[model samples]
Target: MSKKLTKNKKKYRDKISHNKKYSLEKAIEIIKKTNFVKFNASVDIAICLGIDPRLPDQMVRGSIKLPNGIGKNTIVLALVDQERELEAKESGADYVGLDYIEKIKSGWTDNIDVIVATPSVMNKLSILGKILGPKGLMPNPKMDTVSTDIKKSIEEFKYGKVFFKSDRYGIIHSSVGRISFSNQHLLENIKEFMRKIIQSKPSSSKGSYIKNVCLSSTMGSGSVSLDIKNFD
Candidate 1:
């Protein structure tokens, strides 16, 4: 590593020790201090779990309507029929259409935050899976991003409904709130998110599921260990 990068890492390490685990409030407070960027950065939580992710029954995936919406702009792409197109746009879908399907077919998915589609249109999306699947943009009914109610889905997503999934490493990483939000709001969101995660635990694992939790900022300043039971 370069001398400057090492110096910056030392700066953060000075503020926080590696072994100390902080409470929920203290962790959120430290998270704000780590934002060195000019823009209002996102506050994220990374939960490391103990599970065999390759097992069929050990997958973790869910969505939540955060108590306080994520402060960043959420762009939604809605795929629906003629009747629902107007409602989708009215509900704040950034892009809506059959034309979107064509655009996506031609490899044009850009600047999109979330994708919402009706059941009728899901059948037509087989071709775009390779494009959208890797990005987690493919709509799923379990995530509440796929439905017949275009308006509700669009509204929820527009208001910061977050979808999360654990990776092969048995870790679920997602943004909980923005730095601009009140500390109490951030705490509440974190608690709710943790509750959802704990509820979604796979029964087959049988060991300690939540192995570790940490809070940090998008720009990477303060990464603080958090006690799992504090949020529980």
Candidate 2:
């Protein structure tokens, strides 16, 4: 880190108390103030679930719509044939064509945020795995990113749809919205995500599904701990 960034981070670090876990509202307040960047930093949520991801039954992965959207008008890529290209575009998909595979092979994937692929086209994408897999942009049948309903999938992601998959450590992390959004919007997004997570709890799991929950911004070096207020 540069001396200036290091000096600035030191000043901001003192504002966030490592020992304290503020309630959701207060945590959001702190997260807003802690952002020192010139651009609007994305506000993100990270939840640690108590499910064994190793077990097929305990894996938690799904897509849900955010009430206020994920802060960005995500650019979506619909990998379909010539027939569905126009249909995909009409449904609000930014980039729609069967050329996605060729684009991937040529390293032309730059602005893509998510990809929706038809079931038939997915088999041809095996060669692009090494390029797309690590980026989490690969189409997956489980997440419904690979589907025959091209238009619906395009519209869903064009609006406010987000797909999340837990990491090896059972932590599901995603950006809820930007710092410019209202507290109500951010709070609603967080609550909606947690609600889905709870509803998706594995019946075979033995402990609390939501082991721990917190919210933090992309700017601050330290975590802005959140102690969410209990709800029924």
Candidate 3:
């Protein structure tokens, strides 16, 4: 059975054409205009890739520092030794030290957006993988969430560096900016994001790496597809 759309959602749906693909600029405009939610809605981009995620060789994933930061402030948790705690704190980590490991062990993982850990403390954190892994909070070397340079890692994350990975469906979804952002900022972010994804394309993947790109707001009734040619 189809679920009923709310009056507001219906109004939003009426504004969108399901079959048409829009330019990134036009799509951003539509997303901002149709965002009926009272609160500022995040503008998210979804890039559907032509890859078999099940085949690790074909996976595409990496991180990028957007030219225009996503509107949300990141709250960083640094899991480091005592000597590095001050470094982490000075670098903008909201929470620091190994105690949070115990806190995490006791189900105290709250108010933290990213977790950065030093090489020395990774062994201590290894036990909590079961708790943090599924949450995408577990510090990993590949994402730079685990590093010897605690300060740099913490600062990068606290500033704007965000990680992205392909889901089982081979689509990558990330927040480029908020509806309040100017069209230029959103456009640049989306382009840069696409460039970053393009850079991470696996050699094993063949033909038309990106299937389609779409943009949608937090409460938008439907996504506005984009002309993939623009990114190329």
Candidate 4:
């Protein structure tokens, strides 16, 4: 690697190392103690939990509008069959599409954040499995994208439905962000996310599905961990 490239890699590695360990209580304490600059800025925080990956589809996907709102601009994309394209458009989606597969495969997907799609379109796009697949943008039946409810899906996506999968260690990770948000706002968002995850526990699963959760800011600081049992 070039010297500059090597330096950048080292910086990135160092950054990751610094964020690897933290406690939820510490995270909550930070939120409780820190005086946020932005009244409602959206801050990005990650939650890590142990989950079962073998039961049906392992990925959990959903959206919620943090009660305080993310305090940031969010762009939403909705893909539907020709007949339902108008519904997506009328629902106030930033971008609506009847045929977005081609564009998505062509690398045009970099412009968007959230995506909502009807069953038909989602199925057809599955053919590009290799493309949207890696980016975690592919609509999955398990995640509820294969439905005809365009308006409802779009609205939910507008709020904060996140896609999460467990890592090799059985940990699912996701981010919540708004740079200027207050501690209270961040806490509420975290609580809402935890509620959804708890509600999704499978009946067959035993013991703790969520082993633990941790929160951190995008600025790359130490993480704060939360007690999963507290939610119980």
TM-score of each: 0.93, 0.86, 0.93, 0.71
lDDT of 2 by residue, 1-232 (tens): 4677778778877888877767778887878877777778888888888988788888888999889887678899989989888899899998888876787899988799889999888779999899999998889987778999988888888878888878889999988889999988888888888888888788898866666777777766567766644322
Error of 1 at 154 (Å): 0.5
lDDT of 3 at 19: 90
Model 4 over residues 1-232: C-alpha lDDT tens digits?
A: 3565456445543444333444444465554333233354334555554456655554444544456555555577787777777787887789887566777777787667666677666556767678767776666666655567879877666666555555555565666656455556666777777787777666666775676566655433345556565566
RMSD of 2: 2.6
Q: Ten-residue segment with the worst summed lDDT in candidate 4?
A: 32-41
Using lDDT as the measure, the top candidate is: 1
Pairs in steric clash, model 1: none
Q: Which ten residues in a row have the lowest lDDT in candidate 2?
A: 223-232
Clashes of each: 0, 0, 0, 21
Please list all clashing residue pairs in model 2, or write none if there are none. none
Q: Give the TM-score ranking, best first.
A: 1, 3, 2, 4
What lDDT, from 0 to 1, does candidate 4 have?
A: 0.61
**Candidate with better TM-score, 1 vs 4:** 1
Cand. 2 Cα-lDDT? 0.82
Compared to the true structure, candidate 3 yields what TM-score? 0.93
Report the C-alpha lDDT of model 3 over 26-86, residue by residue, as the tens digit: 8888887777777778999889999999998887766788888888889999888898788
